[model samples]
Target: MTSLTPNTVAADAEGLTLIISGDGIGASSMLQWRGVDYPIDWIVDVDGDGGSLGSAIPASALAIDGTFETVLVTVSTGGAASNPLPVTIFGPGVGAAESAVAGAGGTVTASTGRLTATYTRAAGGYGTLTAVDYAFPTDPLLPPNPISPVAFVDLQLLDGVAGDTLVGTFLPPNPILPPNPVLPPNPVLPPSPIRLAYWTGTTWAPVSGSGAVAPTFSFDWATSSASSATVTFDMTSTPQITALGGTVIAFVSAFAFEGFSAPADSDINVAKAGRAVPLGWRILDLGGNPILNLSSSSVDVSSVRIVCESLSGEAEPLDAYAPGSSGLQNLGDGYYQWNWATEKSWAGTCRLVRFDFGDRNPDGSPIYRTAAFQFTR
Candidate 1:
């Protein structure tokens, strides 16, 4: 059999097509389709030629809603019979059709014409869903029905002092809410379980504190005017960040609805560090490259400070330094250094260091880092 497109065929609608080709049968050969030698009446060969035959079977002749293994035999005028070709068929209601796609950190699948979508963030970062489209052939009288409109979401990762949190805005299939109540509500229907997960580069792992827990992720319908609701992944209660980079996928499923979405290029950055100085520190980009030059006559530094917290939770603040400050030294190629003798007090304990760099561009956001560190004795 050349093609067995669908697992199940609708009795009143379209059926299956079987094509056969061989050199053993001649033009005068008779092609017979049967269930174990008992001929079936539904097989109609478009061309009666022997060497190759294409037959179309109607749904009504498939007998009942069950499995059918039909065999095709070709008998030539010379009394020679070709090898039997077996084809399997299933009646309507046997199985449903499914399709899916994935974004930066998400996936979507359809089962039996039902749609489901999911999103996850493994390394705890940001992501977004761009678009979604689907169609179904459920009704015989009408053309293939489309899911119409698309769904989207904006995911933001907030690494706060307390813990990490994933905030997501889920845009429904329809962006504009209907002023009149004639149209159905957004989401059409809410997906069940509203799962959040992280991609392990190989597979998806469910996020911690996902079910039956206080401070777990929650989805509400009226959180935003442009979305079904806002979904917040409570990373503070159960931290899910494992590495510096990875994706996240969230899944939502319902009887007639299912879909998934992933952020685009949602990779977390590993904080960069420079050569050490006695009680001093330097910060650089991932490539060991420094930020824009701050020592030039035209370049102005707004502010720079270091926040230190010891393992015992003792917090202290370091003095601000500028490019030409007394303990701050200008290193060639945009790199600068800061020295503070007071850092010696943070010895023998895990210390958390945060470096804040403010540039002259008032409108631009200041650069900051929490992962930078320098152990002191």
Candidate 2:
């Protein structure tokens, strides 16, 4: 004897259906997820119940709420039957209706935002199918789970419809500020006692260095004569010097004396001899090799200071070669002497002196001098 089994089954967002191909003699039954019997009425042309199938088993018998559920078809027949299989029923968030229609089965299920309809059949011939519609949830609600201020709000109703759109607006974070302001200028070097450039609002003009001073456009001279004249000129920010219109010349001349070398005085005889001349003098000639002169012409020694060294390596306090003490007072005029009597030395050692000059060329460059000698007993 042949058994009765479900040969076809179908489901949509609205409801589920099962078709059992009947054989010679057998009965078909519907099962639910709980393995319990679910009421089902046979579809027929004539009325069996009070009036129709609706009267025998209410539509609620096959209808599922907005919750996950499943149903199956079971057949009891001649020889043997397969195990009862279950087909899950998902909540119709997008399309749901009160009752099944003649064409679609039951009320349509509703859709949330961007949701697709999925229908499945199990233990039956029909396969699972999926359908998408632009229609989605209309009322947007915050995501079931959220993190920060930003969240995905699902729009209901409209989610299942085609060509539907979801739109929303939110404020962003604030802007950032700009950087700090700039500072002004402050002067350090003295304005005078030093040759300076002209003030040009922003910076000093006629800045001089590297072998030359700033440029001069004109020489405004208030001179008595070419030989003994004082020439004045305007030095611009540039270097090349020129006369305004006419040609003018001011000659600078000096006198010199050439002679033999000066005798080196004994360091011990400094007291009795009263003064001892320097190793070299400011002279035109000394033993043929020019003397280590001090002037704007050659050895331009500006300020001289004396430090005495002893044989024991101890040193004395530094003494300036001022006007009355040493002959260095007339730096440019004549020769001078450094005597041990006036500029005393420490007990065990002789004198070791070092000289320094301000701006080797009277134009700001460093110059240095050093000498050593032994005082007799």
Candidate 3:
């Protein structure tokens, strides 16, 4: 719908086309909005009799300005007779913004924009055509209906222009919800029914929607003196799938650390270390599939680093590495991500496959980092 309000004066000048269909040999009638009638326009095959009113006018020409409201058309089936079906015709002036027309097998051409409308009376006296707005439904921060089935929830943040900052805490139902006076002086916005959480720099806030009721949210912030801190929220616990948009990983400090070397010396005293046997080296031929399982039997290593080369042409690597006896690491886990980055530059060719691994031995010993796997496209 246009942003203009009702009662706004509209204009019209151009003519309009009204198409009407006939059944058998019948006389069709035309009527004006309040009740004026006109002879149904007819077509004649010069060779045939002008008997009874032939087929209804294939197309009728009418002078219509945008402001014209309604007109009417009626079909008269004679002799072996049928009821006079009244067809309502609307011009742009009626404010009928959308309409549909039967195309093939009872289907319709979707309605769009301001235009003329023609409704055909069906066999059962029902109007086969209906009109509705063409605009798409919006996803607002709040919802008219409210219900919470699960303890955890996802809230949407209000979208804003670049450089805009959401400084205060957002209230439930409305972003302008009153704050809990008992807590420190925190500016708050009302809550929304759509419970998607958003970040307002220092903390997370819920986006509000229509009919959303006010609810309390616990706030938590994680930070460390190290260059970066890894927060582990279970994938099954939260709804996020990819590491992008609205979410972030923060690095508190910036420092360059020394790069370690691959293992070189083969022999060592009994107390120093055990022999390093080459672990299983294999190709990750299947790209784009989930990493279902990873199995390996090795002689000596504190940690193992795996890299999917760009050739893997896969989506982001699934977090599949295990740290010590922690079992399987959750996908998107940073332990495997950080270690692999330190071990190798892993990027696969666009349409090719690749793989590599590193044995990160403990006690500052030289760990053996393997070569990247090469493969055909």
lDDT of 1 by residue, 1-377 (tens): 22222323344456555454556433455545443222212335345643234445655455543221222333333556554433333333223322222223442222221222233433333332211111211223222222121221112122222233343333333212223345333331232213333334554344343232322223333331222333344433223322312132323221111111111001211111221222233433222344333333322223223343422332332223222324445665544444323234444333333333421011223233333233334
TM-score of each: 0.20, 0.20, 0.20
In candidate 2, what are the lDDT values of residues 246-336, reduced to their tens digit? 1111110111223111343223212211233343334322112222344332223332333434333322232222223333433343453
> Which parts of model 3 have CA positions greater than 4 angstroms off?
1-17, 25-34, 42-72, 79-96, 99-110, 113-377
Whose TM-score is higher: candidate 2's or candidate 3's?
3
TM-score of 3: 0.20
lDDT of each: 0.31, 0.26, 0.24
Candidate 1 clashes: the total is: 25
**Residue-wise C-alpha lDDT for candidate 3, range 1-377, written one tens digit per residue:** 01101111122323222233444532444422124343444444423645233222222333333222222233333323232222223333232232222312232222323111232222232222322211112113212211111111121111112221111122111111232335432111011112233234454333222123222243321210011111112122121212112231111001111122122111110111121212122212111122222323221224332332432322332223323232222233111211221122222221111122211111212233333222111
Which 10-residue span in candidate 1 carries the lowest summed lDDT?
A: 257-266
| Alpha-carbon RMSD to native, per candidate | 22.6, 40.3, 23.1
Cα lDDT of model 2 overall?
Answer: 0.26
List, in order, the clash count of every candidate structure: 25, 37, 38
